[model samples]
Target: MLQAHEADIFRPDVTVLAPQEAVPARRERFATRLSPQDLERRAWKRRVNTIHVNTDVVVKAVARFDQMLADLADDVEGQCLVVPAPSGAGKSHLLARLQMRPSLVPFRDEVGPVRPLVFIKAPSPCTLKTLGLALYVALTDLELSATLKEHDIWRRVRHQMHAQLVSVVMVDEFHHALRGRTGDERRALVETLKNLVIPDPNDPLRPPGAEMRPISLVLSGMPWLRRVLKEDFQLLRRCIFMPIRPLGHSAACVKKATKFLELIEPRLGFPAPSGLSEHDMVQRMLKASAGYTGRMMHLVKKAAFRAIRSGAPSISQLDHLAFVFDEIFELGPHRNPFRVPDISTCPKLKEIEFDKLTRLMGTAQADIDPDDA
Candidate 1:
């Protein structure tokens, strides 16, 4: 369980502080006198830090996914895992966590040090040559010869993979490869990716000195990645499709959401406790965030900042959140979850799907306008 004060905050330099030091330092800073604008700025900065609320469902899913990757690593089978989710559903965040596992670290081998994992984002206009070059750069930190043909680029990539002893390759934003391409182009791109995991036995690029070991692949992207996989039978057969959906409206989901709020409430630096776990408040929050974990946290963080700027001890009622939602989203009272007395009864809430809400909320930071700051 991650306490509110122990939550990871984002730093401009991207250096993370130890939890013990960071929490106290933050509390001390909040205690000092400052201008209202500065206070709001400081409060808003907390948005960058992730509050990992470990619900049973999320924990089990991550554990299962990790176990699958681990199994693939040991066998070196050219199997793949496809993780598809709507934006802000935490797909990227989850991949970031997986990259930190000790099992994925480099280790000593008879030959030398062997890197077990390599993570890279698919190039914007993803092509065989560009993708190969990206992998080459990730492996050797050197540019591939632009003069080389696409096949030659892949040859170098294969050689480097053997040299580094990479067991897993995680490609994020894989959907970029399929964007704006013809059917034939998409098919060619899929084939190129397929060869990366399961190479042709007759290929001339096979490194002579290194043992042939299978490499596992983990690809993550938006929901459209399913379409790309469907275009290639081999790609679909070689991978496991995992779709991460938003938490549905259910008692279990509400319970998880409530617990998440309880954990975050204490860390907001409130002088007194806020009854955010109350049934009505919890329900309102769930409705506002449309049961998306990322959006839920965004709402809480923004509301906390608003409370601090207002000199309030805690965020206690729907009215407090209503102000922040209206200011951030520019939505009318009828559409704002925080402004409505009964979310279910609100016609606007009933009309919009959770996916649309996820898109509307795009980036939580977008809520903070520069002029307002």
Candidate 2:
């Protein structure tokens, strides 16, 4: 060997690490304050961490939804209510709670000896078959012990579902199904929903509206879903469309904001971290967040990282929230980044920011009146 130190056989860096070991370390996939075990227990927690909360509004919405289902079991012929809230308004969270509420059990008792409440989150498959399949999956997920094809599963499911007196189908992410590529796909959704809703020939009861789709539904998604429905006014009129406005700075919103944060805090590292004074920091967070649920969490999550890296011991409140808005959003004093309304005990009207806009002068040429030009 010309030089032992330079020989390829002596390449210490290459020989020391295996290819897999050489791979760069990735950041943990776990939520900020979550222990690894917590994610596995809930199963849905990781998925949920990605969703923001607008609970103050959603609680009331879920209550109304509960009542609607109760009305359905009583054969009250209720029109389906679509709780149309913003993307980050925790629409899915509301849907989850609707299934978990204590009020729901009574509907089952009155409707049948063992009525099962079914909740399905639409999958990305976007076809009728896949949606139907997903519904089956959701049922199984609910611990129904019903397999997809166990000799007359649908027949058994149909009877069992019917006998229970009330089967409420709540589909979160209704928008995915709305974007059907072909008429067949769209028709499939319409038909499947029709089957779940309106009476099938084999169905025990005719759809409430007769011509209307039955099976009480709480179809929810972002604002765009409403527009998608509006494309077909006939179909939309059948729905009880109630839109949830995003939360902005207000007393009620503050309470909601705090509650939501508290829900996540224990998991995200808490007593809300050291610097956070409940009264002062929460208000600051409310202002900085502009009352957008998702954005607020995004800020806090990022702040957690910042705090962790800096060894700040717990990020109660980080000033970086202001930077993200001021620098990235260019939101200055007296300006808000979100379009949500302020909270109020009474219904309030929306205001237009006319002062920020300039109107062009009228285009007509002036009459030649003694050299006015």
Candidate 3:
């Protein structure tokens, strides 16, 4: 089995694990004060064991992904699947599940290991050389010297993908390829990706009449990635676009979002009902989360933990959510949507304030630097 590097760019964002068997144990430890280890274990269990909610958007995106894989089985030349969404819209979570599909699992045979799917994030300052290295790392455990020439690294990546029978290459945060780069650099990046889906015949590695095994590409990033693809007609034509829409204020959207929270509440292990699906609570949640699924889940998780630490039986009241929201965003009573008397009167932000969230969480966002090679 080939192990991916620990760096963010070379590793999958999430790992989907099979459901674990329930362990038989003595009960009645509720009175005991929970230690840090216990708290973390509870959080981990909630994350891994939560039921997967399939909204209309998720069902369609998954169906499209399956179709992409099915086409490969028929020896169809690889096509691109582009999933563009706002930050914290659960795009990475969706990609993670797709990567772990039974059919795409890595396997080995008499020849060697065959990886049906390779997932890697595009590195920040994504030069061709850096992108190649990211692919190489995800494809194999072997360490390659960073001093290798750009073309040389890409040649090796192409050869390895072919040899390993890689059917799909998922590049998460692909918009990194265009950020703060020159027009020429963007063009080069776009062309390189296009060539992956439809191999360039002029390449020295491909003999005039030899069969070229094309690898399908999955490019996922923020909505800006769509504009980038549009700039290059060839790449745009090859792509199947899927967007993960955020939870909105519409009646249907609110109802769906409320139901989603209801599903998650049971998984939090609270003894009492939280009434997360109530119209008032759901509306306040929508504002606090900026209608982003990821942000909403993050808020819920934090509130659950706060309740646990404070010896509350459940995340049962609006105050529980309000306290955590204020703690997370450093907002005053009036500014916190959850605390406000009229949530409708509160000003809405276009997106979740992820920078503040990250600071509160005490984790630096990983942007793989090319120079770190």
- Best of the candidates, TM-score: 3
Candidate 2, residue 60: Cα displacement in angstroms equals 2.0
For model 1, what is the alpha-carbon lDDT of residue 237? 87
RMSD (Cα, Å) for all candidates, in order, is: 11.5, 14.2, 10.3
**What local distance difference test score does each model get?**
0.70, 0.51, 0.75
Tens-place lDDT digits, model 2, residues 1-373: 5586568577657656566655542233433676665544344334434544445556677667767766665552434568665434445555666677774553424434543466666665345555555665555444334345432444444444454544577777676655535655565355445455545555443433233324677787645556445544445666776665656667787677677677655565433354332655556555544455644566566555454444454553324444433443443433432222331221222111111110111111111113211
lDDT value, residue 133 of candidate 1: 89
Candidate 2 stretches greater than 4 Å from native: 1-55, 76-78, 103-115, 141-160, 163-166, 200-214, 227-235, 248-290, 297-313, 316-373
Which pairs clash in model 3? none
What's the ranking of the predictions by TM-score, best on top? 3, 1, 2
RMSD (Cα, Å) of candidate 3? 10.3
Candidate 3 on 127-231: residue-level lDDT in tens?
777888988999997757889987788778878877888889998878777667777777877777777777777866443454576778898876777756776
Which sections of candidate 3 miss by over 4 Å? 1-51, 205-210, 316-320, 355-373
How many residue pairs clash in all the candidates, one count each?
Answer: 0, 5, 0
Residue-wise C-alpha lDDT for candidate 1, range 1-373, written one tens digit per residue: 6666555553356767799889987998788778777866575546424556765545755686677666764654477878886555666666777677788887777887688888888786666677788999988889978789987898788888888878888888787776566788778767766766676666577787566577778888767677777877876888877766666668887887788888877666677877778887777777676566766666777677667667677774554678767765566888777777787765433312343444444422112113322
